[model samples]
Target: MKKFWLLIVFVSILFSCSDNNTSNKNPYIPSYSVNLSIDMNLPAYSNLKFVSNGIIIPNYGAKGVIIFNAGSGYTAFDAACPNQALTSCTAMTINGINAVCSCDKTEYSLFTGLGGKEYPLKQYRVEVIGTVIHVYN
Candidate 1:
């Protein structure tokens, strides 16, 4: 009886496993480790204190990263356009609450990071502790 239960559990575990790489792969942007800390008290990062505002910090990700204030919390995303390969014009620029790709003119919302056709912006994890905002992969 114990052997039968073990076999059933093994089969269930095998069936429940999924090939996550095949489904969630984004072939455009190269992966980079992002460990950034932004102080809201600083003059350069003070703009992030308000909702619907975003700031682009260079020398971080594939094409730097854009940190946005989404009212409820903060969010960060790779500035590279996810629709195509990294090119001269692939770096996105902040326009209000959206990040616009100069290459294909694709507009990605900073609020939800949704834009383009299939893949959305590669978002990093954001955590706000007091006045310090921690952004990481």
Candidate 2:
């Protein structure tokens, strides 16, 4: 019957339109074969306040960010916004003790490595063995 075909068509369309929600896929984190060390007393370290290479590093295990301080220390974190993961703009800019992402202007505290405005920046583990900094996934 025409009504039966119409019903089937409507059901098919509804199922097709249903959100194909996929699980959050982990990002990739590059490996460093050589160990690197930076001196905090160096002029280059003291001169530059912030650095941006316009590159995004995936965490592999989860969404995160990594900040390397040649002079002082190294930091890593999850790039996903703590408040909400709906937006793709979770990357943040470091401003002293805070990291602010241009998208939504979400501010995260670098000191505590937590998100502000009811969200916190998920932090990763960092090991400083002398001048060498190790960031692991």
Candidate 3:
């Protein structure tokens, strides 16, 4: 009877265990360390001052980095589309607070990073110091 109870306990423990394995993952893209800063006072970056607006900085990351000024604060994300193939056209362009991928027209919200795509947009870190905005990964 003791062995039977031990076996039952072992079976119960086994049944209670849960597996956390998840196969739904984003595309495999190499992570590159990003460190960039922009002056919001500049004419080119002045558009970032308003909510639901963003600007793309060239020559950074796989494609570039999109900086957005959300209503709460600011956010930065990789310009590369997370759902599509990595190509020049896979880069995202700013349309209000949404980042639109030119390849498949996948639009991701700049504020929440969610959209109709399979995954959310790849995001970076944002730090604001006066008129200067620093974006990094």
Q: Highest TM-score among the candidates is held by which one? A: 1
Candidate 2 lDDT, 1-137, residue by residue in tens: 99965664554344324343221122322222222243434554433234321112453323445444422334545555555553556455566546676667766644344454554455445566654444443
What tens digits encode model 3's per-residue C-alpha lDDT throughout 1-137? Answer: 99965664453333223131121234634577789989989999988888668888977877888887765567777788877777547578888768898888878877656677577677776778999999876
How do the predictions measure up, each by TM-score?
A: 0.80, 0.46, 0.76
Clashing pairs in 2: 27-60, 63-79, 64-78, 64-79, 65-77, 114-120, 114-121, 115-119, 115-120, 115-121
Residues 1-137, model 1: lDDT tens digits = 99965664453333224222321256887778899998999999998888778899999988998998876667788898887788666579999878998888889877666675788787777778999998876
Q: Rank by TM-score, highest first.
A: 1, 3, 2
RMSD of each: 11.9, 19.2, 14.3
Off by over 4 Å in 1: 1-24
**Model 1 residue 55 CA deviation in Å:** 0.2
Tell me the TM-score of model 1: 0.80
Query: Model 2 compared with the native: what TM-score?
Result: 0.46
Q: Name the candidate, 1 or 2, with the larger lDDT value.
A: 1
Which 10 successive residues of model 2 have the least lDDT summed?
21-30
